[model samples]
Target chain A: MKYKDFNHWELAEDAYFVNWVLRPNKHADKFWKQFLADHPEKSEDVLLAREIVTNIRYSDKPRLNDTEYNDLFERIISTKRSKRPSNVFYVREAQYRWVRYVAAVTLVLASAILYNQYWLSSHPSDEKTIQTLVKESPRGSKLTAVLSDGSKVKLNAGSKITYPKEFSDTLRLIYLTGEAFFEVESDPARPFRVKSDKVNAEVLGTSFNVRAYPDDRKISVAVAEGKVKVTNADQSTVRFEHTLLPFQESEINVQSNQVVKRELQDDMIFAWTNWKLVFKEEPLSLILKKLERWYGVEFELKGAIKTSETYSGSFDNDPLKVVLEVLTSQDAFDYEIQGRKILITSKY
Target chain B: MKVFSESSITSNGELKKTTSSRKLSHQEIVQGLEQGDESVLGYIYHRYVQDMFGFGSQFTRDRELVKDSIHEVFASLIARRQSLEKIRSIKSYLFAAVYHRIIYDIKKNTTFKNKNQKNNYREFNIEFSVQNRLIMEESNREKLNKIKSAIKNIGARQRQAILHYYYDGFVHEEIAMIMGLKNAHSVTKLISRGLKAIRESIAVVVVLFMTDLG
Candidate 1:
């Protein structure tokens, strides 16, 4: 450093000295403290230099306003999105969801096979996939797949489905972690079964929706066009079984091992298939959770939410900002959007 | 100073590498850059926008031109990410890239503007912020006054070299690349010449401080 002859002006302009003053860490502190101890005569100059650098500010510092920042951010993101991998098979998102998902979501579909493979290989303990084909959707993206049996599957966000590229002659089976809608091709000889954690839905030839996210307490199987046989996925001695017809939904309480059945006026339980968020008198907390996966954003509530109250609204392929604005319009809350994160707060 | 053991303090010319990590390593950023990771690009943008803007403004007065040049630098960085040549320092690379892009824009538009516009804008302009930290002390103010005069006395090229070395926290090697100098030895020479001017002024302040104490 030749710092013995270097005065405070020269010391203040030293790159290492300025870095120590501005961006301090243990190593920098140690280095400077040692310098002070070694050069007691120069300590006064070093201290004055440190003070100058600490208070130094640039005069012509430029900044972009919120609108300008977001405009530039979007422009750059759009430029990158066009160059995203356009191959279909590599994208683990649902084949049908890609259409509406592209129109509504922030991220355009890119093949996650390579990204997912990297994740899967790194995380070997998380129940390795044995199936020939693995289809997965990250938060905020939906994927579609057509099984070898001609059955079409729409995989929801933060979910994974594993099935053989070619189904075996004996029986067709697929494992589910999150939620998915299946339109099983009629195969009388080989039954199509959706094996989940709590509920196993077996159908001969029909279309149905299964909600079995690992975090959810209840796993439900709702039949839309055909009969579905629901059975306990647990391989214990006492096996529970139930059959559900069209317009019927079966909720299996995972903790209680109890089964509840309900009838709907219409088989529109799968409104999400059309990219519609339908919540009829649903609690605000639950609605926010659904919005997180739908828009692929995180919501941080600042104040106390009126948990006693329930919300009922249907957002059909609306942007997340609109959905949040509409939700908090009459309610006691406010919202702020930054990148993929949204902060929602209650007024009182 | 001779190379202080950088094993703990500063890894010269290495961004995102430190005894205290900035959470992203150079290898990780390069890997993410190749994959067109927007978050990595965003991190780099947020980290260096001020420096980039300041560096870009030195060449031209048009704010939009500076912004466009900044945008083009990032766009090209991403477009050519897969085959990007080795980038030693992201900050210096962006600075040099922005410099070239603004120059190119200015060159193309020289038809409408005067032919001497290139020479007029060829200078590196810098002004230290007048934030008074030593406002309370007379001798501290005198110390600052000497520095102001010294900065005024230094050559134009030496001022730019000092700015890159001190204000931007760039090592001599990175400053060499950014300033298009032949090598780091020249960068050290340029900075030392500038520092000597400032040091001489500070010496006069030291003599004044002794007399004031007496």
Candidate 2:
């Protein structure tokens, strides 16, 4: 029967009406409201039908209890865990293949230089002392290093850390570029200082992340676990500095020397440490830059992007192509990838 | 092969590949699983195991068997992720995979004692429950039971379409994919027909009640 011919009881039995009551969305709400307004007499029928649809109970469908679900989930995870060793082996194999090639070349050169210095009767006493060690993470990878004072530093992609082999009695200092998370060993007598190009972060016994990429317009410091003192390192007329507490972040604009401080959510600031990327309403320009550094690829923008265009999203260990696909899906853009470079253009 | 070799080039080349592995989407998780990433396998399990188990239970009363089928489907997905084609909807793909596994298990065990089980497996059914607080009158309760039975009397395909669409909250396209229909049009037809039958049955019950009351 046509919907117009149906009485209140028959309207109540209509599946579309019942489904609308079960799960109402914007469109459904509009349609039902319009229907009620068009046929005021059917209002009681619509209400009764909704009641009937919501009241029908199906007792025959099989159900899995919560305990069963949890048990099954654990079993599946355990099965994957049992197979993890082989996966780890493959990762190690892939890592070592490159490490071995680099190590071999460096080892041969080092041995030749050492032999020349010792056996050629050179005055070794005049040689410069190698009192500092420099550790760098390439464009797409992160690197962790242990300082002589037992503190650990995690360097983000395309970053570097230079530290002394031995700490001085007065202070423990490390030079940083790009970004790094520092877990300083507690020694109240000696302050730990990280000197980046644009900013210097000092702490007594705390952990924090400092991001000071040279080309970026701003430098930011986020405190994760402890307090930190951040000061402008640039030799400019006006300097910006701030003392950041736990879950606090400070950003210093390089061009204007304006400092902005605010409370930060742990996930937003420290997701990178767990290998996740979280961007909240960040400009497309900044997102692309971060993606370029994280993926080790060059992004050439071929079209104009509005300055106000921003994207907020998070990803946890996805390939570059997939991440690019998701980003472009939202905006009107097309991208082409060639070897190590990606060209993004307007989708017109 | 070229990708692997490129990853071993220099620190610069390594950095590029390393960054690519930082964040994962659903598609990436599938790709990672294929590449023998145990973490991705764990991720897929945690994300969809409950939904899969609920859907699988419809085919059989054996909860353990349903659980086993879910486990087997995921294990096989991990084992075959490398060769598995790109899936458009992870949810529908998983539902279809688990559905096939349960059907196969049922067919395999169709012995003399399992003959009744075969009949039960052939028909798709869902349990519906009304909120206890909403049932205020005896006649309303009677009307609800009539509608529930009417839903059962509809064709199996119609019942499956309604259950998948309404109860499971799957879109028409996803329901079509899961139910092996030609397209979403078929699913829409099945659901409408099922609802029509229920309406007819409820109308008859309503007339009988009114006449008896008079």
Candidate 3:
């Protein structure tokens, strides 16, 4: 009979037969062993299913580990840096505000040209460009630059940059990973785009910095001037953009695609540019994310304690001991920071 | 299956010793794990890791993934060990948990579950090993290929249920839970129907084989 002729009961019966004979549990093995004795003709089918199931069970593709895990941890934990600080061009909105607008306009034009030449070569005129960027920087190396039109960017170590060579007239686009400080140029006719691995940050004429790493689910953008929009790529049809008024910071969680915007010390947004740890009621995950970047080590958390409890405090280049002490000070928590891994628990 | 073959399982003789030194009972093991006792965790790993790893090998021959999945199972057990009362049997619990985790990880990385059934079957086509390879005296390789093709013609869901439950010895409830069934009854029905289909199809081919022999 055709499979379609089988009623739900019949279908379920065949399903069970295939599953039972193919994957043989104690129950199925006993049942089928008895079954073949009564209906000897059914033996071939049972054997076929068993062989097929055996084959399928053994067929699986392998998963590879992230080779850069140690390097990522090192960058998060260590503070030692190069003495030859090559004129690090840190761009704030105040110093070169006009450069932001120029960059924004150029981003728009570059995107338009790239879209026409690549994406819209055969399509009708109403074409939109979907730009993607994937950039990664090595450890101890930081990238500082002003785009052709004037948007300033300061890239942190172990970061990635992928974007269209230029922005389309309608939309300006760029992509980032790791961390970067952005001074976006403003243009009402176009919206500048910085699509991180998990998020898309957009703005007109504003000065902000975004720290978004692919491996880490948290994407942080702090606005120092004008307004900004940070959208979750995993969610939203038209991009979730946060209009960042000055002195405000927003973190977008990639896993849940949840956004949290908070007001903080405006100076802290630019503080990391000068080597600092700024914590304002941050979760252990956020602190650990930053700590792992500053120190090259891994953290292994075990036990019954929930790691989401918020810790409120700030430190500027303080000793690593103080950081661990502050984390362990909570009555509900205790921690041990070993050479390369920190183990946090509720036993304290 | 590859990892926990009879050879490796038998080779780890010390692991099989029925020591009378008041070894930790299941409850004690759960308690120690909940209390964050590394010794208890290590004991469980030593006792169960090979079996689980071997069982996982049947699912995929990727050694690293099997190792990764085995570690995840232990880690999850530690995290949930506090509520051990809910687990009826640690044996079934660990097996089902590892199976689900492996499937989820595979689905996420490959995104192959939703594609056409033919591609799915192709992805799972088994390559015979050098030493253990079946050598049919009279039947040629083409006949073996036909048998494989016939097996692939089965439904994907039926095939998965059969493979996980029959080959790995996973119970109906466990299979139901992993396959996202509502209850054991559903799994029972699914296995039954899948088997009947295979049985009927294979019977026809067997008859044809007899006729050809005559």
Name the best candidate (by DockQ).
Answer: 2
Put down candidate 1 lDDT per residue, A59-164, tens digits, no spaces: 3556654333443454454445544343453241222112111110001111122234423433344424434678888889898887776666777887777776
Q: Tell me, by TM-score, which candidate is best.
A: 1
Candidate 3 Cα errors over 4 Å, as ranges? A1-97, A100-135, A138-150, A164-172, A184-191, A197-199, A215-222, A229-243, A248-270, A302-306, A318-322, A325-339, A344-348, B1-214
lDDT of 3 by residue, A102-204 (tens): 1110010101112223334322343554343344555445667665445557666555555554556776666555667665554556666766434556766
Enumerate the candidates' DockQ scores in order. 0.08, 0.11, 0.08
Worst 10 residues of 2 chain A by lDDT: A102-111
Cα-based TM-score, every candidate: 0.44, 0.41, 0.34
TM-score of 1: 0.44
Report how far residue A215 has shifted in candidate 3, in Å: 5.3
- Against the native chain B, each candidate's TM-score is 0.72, 0.70, 0.60
lDDT of each: 0.63, 0.63, 0.52
* CA RMSD of each candidate after superposition: 20.8, 20.4, 22.4
**How does model 3 fare in lDDT?**
0.52
Interface C-alpha root-mean-square deviation, candidates in order:
17.9, 15.9, 19.8
